[model samples]
Target: MLVVRVVPVGRARLVGAAVRRRLVPALTGSAPTASILTTPARCNSQLAADAHRRRHKNVITGPDAVALRLHRGHLVVQHPRWPVDDAFFSLAWLRDHCRCRHCYDNSTFQRKTDVRQLSSVGNPLHFNVNSTGTVLEIIWHDGHQSEYSMRWLWENSYVGARHREQRQSRLWQRCLWDGRRTSAEDLTSVVYDSFMTTEEGVRRLMKGFLTHGAAVVTGVAPTPAATQAVVERVGVVQHTMFGGVWEFTADGRHADTAYGRDELLPHTDGTYYSEPPGVQVFHCLAHHGHGGETTLVDGFAALNSLHQADPAAYELLSRVPCAGEYRDPSRRLHMVGDGPVIAHRAGAEPTPDSLLRLRFNPYDRAAARRGEPAEVEAFYGAYGRLTELLWDARRRLRLKLRPGTVILIDNWRVLHGRASFTGRRHMCGAYMARSDVLSRARSVGLLI
Candidate 1:
């Protein structure tokens, strides 16, 4: 009888689909004809017992004794704690993923091993854990050796990958907030000098921006150039038809009501673009007016509130597509876009992290094509409820922008508007690409 067995190393489980399909046929040639006995890996309880018997290490015994067996071309790993089906890893996979100095380049963080040549490396003839149980040593059929830390192996295992994914999902979850919960004082505010001079200040700015969907920098030089500088520091300028850095007054320079004194409702910009800007910067260079207060509504917080109050309405908004268009005949500019009022990340359910963008701009919104009367009624009913929440004064954070105060908003998450003004109010601001803002945030460790 040809028997092959070794003591189990650690609590490794979860063989991914790809590894199972590719390695199983390559390893076994066909199903096994002989019986194979295998033991589950040492779980925490077993590790504790092992610790107690460390004085007589390598003397594993009892029902939970560590052991490995070859059934197909896979290393089946059982876990006593789970009492589930065995997990597996291929001998070829083990060899290809060896992180030794020869197979990997730590300096560049690249693999040196040629995966195409893995077939010639031969199978693992024998494998065992070190006395400390921290390392797994394998002697290959071709006399080559490989060693991998138990910690690394566990992390790469199916259970480990799932754990990592969950942790990341939690980290990426947005901290949704409304005006009642978040006030001007609650927001992260930095002085212009500190924000411009210190890396820590920038990191703090990004962290707050990601956490609250908005932040403020005070005491910035009250000039267009200064505002442009501030925007550049955070991210690259996202050029639009308006220009890279745009300044507008209540003059008839453009066609939009933004050039007039009429009050602008709470809405996100670029509803007519497929991919809207992520961040919007506003620096009131001069506001010698009476009622040009800026209104910021946390769209995520509002949606969450809606979800709690009326889940069906929230679902309606998320499921229905709303069309938007922008047309400037003078400039021969016409753009059209359409998407759900609420959007989610690809391949993910509507979790806080996966709720990617909010496309709510009633100004640019176009009439939907005729639909079933019930569907239209449902859509309008949901849209009306959402609008009421947005228009709620208590839920709005109104800021009377003055010279030297700059507000940076996550355009995709927060809605912005302006109160009708009486006198001169010139504001200079720019848009930043979503990728650029997120890249800046990730560079400062705000997100993974």
Candidate 2:
């Protein structure tokens, strides 16, 4: 009779040794045995065929491991690799690469590095089935080893492969003053005459909105009454203590002193409201005043900068939930939500067409009111970082709104602020609900 035995080597040698120590001595009759030797026919071609089929089915190929044997989508692994099988690889790894400023630092946009540029040292870059044939371990060329359950590798591999695409699609342009001269014509062409009341005009306007978060409408009467009339036709206007009906004036008020400063930081208005207005309409009744240049920033651009500079920070912010608050002697509101400073609706990819939102306010007293010091500290950390990005000159679009102009913005997507005024200034501003705008678009058959 011919006998053959398979043995594991290297790290697997111990298992091989143990198996041989127990079985070989018994088979050779040195140890007492209960049964006698069987006939040669007992180990027939059928048995060999069955064994061969099982072995062939068990081997894994390509970047995947063999233990993760999938037959018609069924997971057949009895055991999985370490760290690789843990959910950390799937969740933490991706979160660490989130392309939002809350998770990254936007100010370092130009310094951001690409993940594909990472160096792969001598780590075993592939997975191999262990000697026991029950699990797989990823071998790095550097001699580092990580075991992953077959299912875990499969799931994470899918996500890991998708990371680059997600990152690229979410990448946005950073609007900066390049020191290069921009012609007034270019600026006017980019921002003005973007809104339309006609079918083709509406199409162009929507397309512009998708490309730029805000656009200017020319040929509209520059008066406050004219601006308010347009706003009312599209949606209900949001009125606030800082509100006015016509070309109203904006000076720093004691209650909300942000607008009073000569230089204003980039920020979204109505952040304190539970459901802040989603769009803002600003009409220039007069621009004879000095400074007070209206600045608009693409929040997506700022977010992309952060994602490039500090991925770890970006991940932390995106994973953590935050509370935004607004309070005064007369009114108070609080909002608790989970999202990055820049985020799209869940299950959707972020794009220029995606709805973008930002939350920035320094005067949140929710933590003190609720007596949560840790939460407050975390919120402040995120807020302080975001503030730094807001004032970054490179990410802002500075413009002076001339009389006879109306600007419409997706408030959630663009952060608007002024560049301080030294003389008499007049402007009219109102909020248009997002629901109403979409409804208006649909009513006019602009959107299906």
Relative to the unseen true structure, what is the Cα RMSD of model 1?
Answer: 10.4
Residue-pair clashes per candidate? 3, 18
Q: Please, what are the lDDT tens digits per residue for candidate 2 over residues 1-448?
A: 2223332222321111111111112112232211111111112233234323554242322222222222221223322222233222232232233334444465774323344533322212333344433334443333444444333343345433454345434433223221133322233222233343444555455444444667666677777777876566556777655554634555544255444636766677666566567888887776565788777776666666555675544544554544555545554523433234454566665533343466654444234344246655665565566567666776667777887777778787678777877766776778877777767655644443
Q: What is the clash count of model 1?
A: 3
TM-score, candidate 1, is 0.70
In model 1, how large is the Cα lDDT of residue 274? 85
* Superposition-based RMSD of candidate 2 using all C-alpha atoms, in angstroms: 18.0
lDDT measured at residue 255 in model 1 versus the true structure, 0 to 100: 67
Residues forming the 10-long window of minimal summed lDDT in candidate 2: 13-22
lDDT of each: 0.73, 0.49
lDDT of 1 by residue, 1-448 (tens): 3233444545564121000010111112332222223333333334335434542235323333333334445555432322334556676788888888988888998998888977755435556554433466776666667887755665576545556666656654457777777777777898989889988888888878888888999999889889988888888999999898899999978768788999998999988888888999998988775999899899988888888899889888888888788889999988888888999988787744468898999888877964456789899999999999987878888788889999999999999999998989989999999899888877776664
Task: Give the winner by TM-score.
Answer: 1
Candidate with best lDDT: 1
User: Model 2 off-target regions past 4 Å?
Assistant: 1-197, 239-247, 250-254, 258-261, 330-343, 348-355, 363-382, 441-448
